[model samples]
Target chain A: PGLQMSQQQINPTRILVLLNMVTKDDLTDSDEYADILDDIREECRKYGNVESLQIPRPLPDLDVPGVGKVFVEFSSVDSAMTAAKAIGGRTFAGRVTISSYLDESKYFAGQFQ
Target chain B: EPQEGKRRKRSRFGEENIAERNLIGAQTVLPSNMTPLQQQCYILHLRIEDANMRLRTGRFGYSDDPSKRSPSPEPVYNGEGKRLNTREYRYRKKYEDDRHEAIQEMIKLNPNYHVPPDYRPPVQKLED
Candidate 1:
């Protein structure tokens, strides 16, 4: 079972999904949110060109999907994969970040909530 | 009486299963393309993550005592070079000192583990 789980690694894609990097409170504050986005972009751009970046913010009285998660779309799969390896397990906002590649189609369909 | 025994056995098995999962989760296989140095760094990264998990879940010593944990390090400015207020600084500082300590321990474990270069150095610090 452990072997199977290890083998189930997701394929590399142009979009990288980062988890555990932010909290709900961080996203709610407008200034903090912008700061986080800039911080992530500056860090990610070191690996390659970042085409688009998104950090889903929480909504009032609504359960927003993907809140506190960061999505970064790079110009190429290689860049995305590189960024994933570099950023994974790295600390952001004092939290260990877990990163994975996301499918381009799903990213485009706005399903990344 | 037999049913009670079976229920207790199942619960024990469940606990063991969870422990096994955690073991596997902590030492995931390193990527094949990495060099020996990169692999060592990756393992250190895993150690850092494990330490963070322990601190977060309060599984170990210092984690159990909130007052014993190290105070927050000085706040670094944001990407745009703006300083963060005290409240914001403390809020972001949580777990940072712990993470830094873990990284230091990891470096001690493997002297070959090269620390990644800091891409964003604090501009204010440099100016000072």
Candidate 2:
């Protein structure tokens, strides 16, 4: 019944999270702006130090108001991968649309699509 | 006699097709693997065309104001009572202007901008 349980077993590795979030409709106001950012940050922070973060502006022609579409960047690759793994196919603020990025050109090209 | 009438109808339809050739010249960007720059440029081009068409021919529109009837069959450029016409016109006008500027910017993006517009398919020569 004896098992070698050490600190690594207890401690958790931090993760980097990057996403291209597309909302169900356009963003009308700043209702979920801070909370949405914070949620993503908190989820990814568990993996490691959040070195950098970014959310790129929406496409010029698209008429997205509050949260139309965005590209979220994270510091650590592992953290980013972890958050991507966790949030794929999850609902954000009631809308069932959230996913992660693989950081590949073709994949991102698809996003341009 | 019936055949002659049918032939006349077909020729009239042909003329209609020729008239719509420019619109047929419009390029369709498949939602496939597109680079961001390419996508942006293509979208800009289409959006500009749409804006100009709305301004010139007055088709395909939106409304910023809620009071007046929007997207009506009768495009009323009326003012004094409703603000909807004014706001949408400005929005449409701004986009039209921006898109025009974008075309100039496009020339900078692609030094090959002087090339013929990608509108029609190349003609095929008949070999004897």
Candidate 3:
């Protein structure tokens, strides 16, 4: 699939992660949010070579925008799993409601195959 | 009388029943005489299938076809800057105001101005 491969080319293989979208009390710029993604990318790089990382930002219109959510992406299945296992539900910005994600369908579907 | 091309049948059992038995499995039709393991497996499969069909459609949304993962972040009054540091509010406010006005201009020129909600700018809702 072009979508999957392009993301992979940017950074091959991907596991999706959902994280706390709590705004930092310190960052202040369009680029500042970009920095959060960069931090996530750096964290991902710890487990293995990271090709790319994405964090989904919610719209400002949604009254609940500040803590809406963010998505973290990883390059390897194993790395993503490790990241999810090691850090899911860990505190972020003094909040502990964050979540780790995975490509669940791919893993679950494989069970039947 | 046997129909043409029909196999001779000395027993009560026949081919059509065999086909149905193959399709639905023999124990379904012959439940009265099922082995315990066969009955248990059949029951379990039925229960599992019932559970599976109810899986929310959104869960299977990501197809191998690709071209997905697009989330439109609405232009906000310093929303991103608000994330970085709440102080960049004024600059973000000006920028977002400009972005919305630009979108309004496009709406004026293009009859197809009805953008998908996700693609639209964040507008303040007035109280009644």
Candidate 4:
């Protein structure tokens, strides 16, 4: 708790949040979800090396807006930026998709909690 | 035989690579910075891209364009499973239409239409 503010602040280099796409039905079937992940990875891999892909699948009964969201972690910041620019506002699963960078701290915190 | 199959696959990918390159070459530079006019153009570009992708994939049969889905007067139903087409229905329809128009008018009157979210990137330690 010292007053020295010269600490090297870490920033997320390669994580994106995809919003307003993927419905409850999309994640129910293994084959369907695999196809979707393939489609997303194929589209995103055009930019750079995709390290990992995460899509939260909430229970079908749960009426949550954040359920069908996707998170893509690339190997580098440049690839993430390129993919975000290309994918943002484009139609995905018939919805106008939006994307932004995911906060590393919050993501890890939520995962642990 | 396996080598032949691999060569054929490579040739197919070569053709796809050429097409992808052409697409990249044809794409115009979209401004990264957001301005009012730029945002409008960006939306239009997204629409065009959506249409193009649909057309390319042969999945362009049905579309839900916003212009076709404008809010209209809601139809009221009678108890006997019939459409109420009386003078009162006409009046109510007009009133409902006027109310919808007022809502739309009020919505458009807002000058600050677009509000970009405050961006805060998640910080984490760099893994060695």
In model 2, the fraction of reference contacts reproduced equals: 0.00
Q: For candidate 1, lDDT tens digit of each residue in A1-113?
A: 21112443456788888765777888888977777877788888999999999888888998876676688999998898888767764556444466665668878887764
User: Scoring each candidate complex against the real one, what DockQ results?
Assistant: 0.02, 0.01, 0.01, 0.05
lDDT of each: 0.59, 0.39, 0.37, 0.50
lDDT string for model 2 (B72-106, tens) is 33444446555454555755555556456656666
Q: Interface RMSD for every prediction, one decimal?
A: 13.4, 23.5, 27.1, 14.4
Worst 10 residues of 4 chain B by lDDT: B9-18
B29-111, model 4: which lDDT tens digit per residue?
A: 22233343433333333333333433344443222553322233566668987777643455344333433433333335545
Best-first order by TM-score: 1, 4, 2, 3
Chain B alone: TM-score in each candidate?
0.31, 0.41, 0.26, 0.23
| DockQ, prediction 4 | 0.05
CA RMSD, predictions in order = 21.6, 21.7, 28.1, 17.7
TM-score comparison, 1 vs 3, better candidate: 1
RMSD of 1: 21.6
Question: Tens digits of per-residue lDDT for model 3 on A1-113?
Answer: 10011111112125544332344332334565665665566555667665545443444464322233444445566675565544433333322222334344533333111
Name model 1 segments beyond 4 Å from true.
Answer: A1-5, B1-128
How good is the docking of model 3, as DockQ?
0.01
Point to the candidate with the largest lDDT.
1
**CAPRI class of candidate 1:** incorrect
lDDT of 1 by residue, B40-122 (tens): 45444654554455545543322234343445557678789987754434533444454565467656767765543431212
| Candidate 1 TM-score to native | 0.51
Report lDDT (Cα) of residue A26, candidate 3.
27
What TM-scores do the predictions have? Answer: 0.51, 0.32, 0.31, 0.42
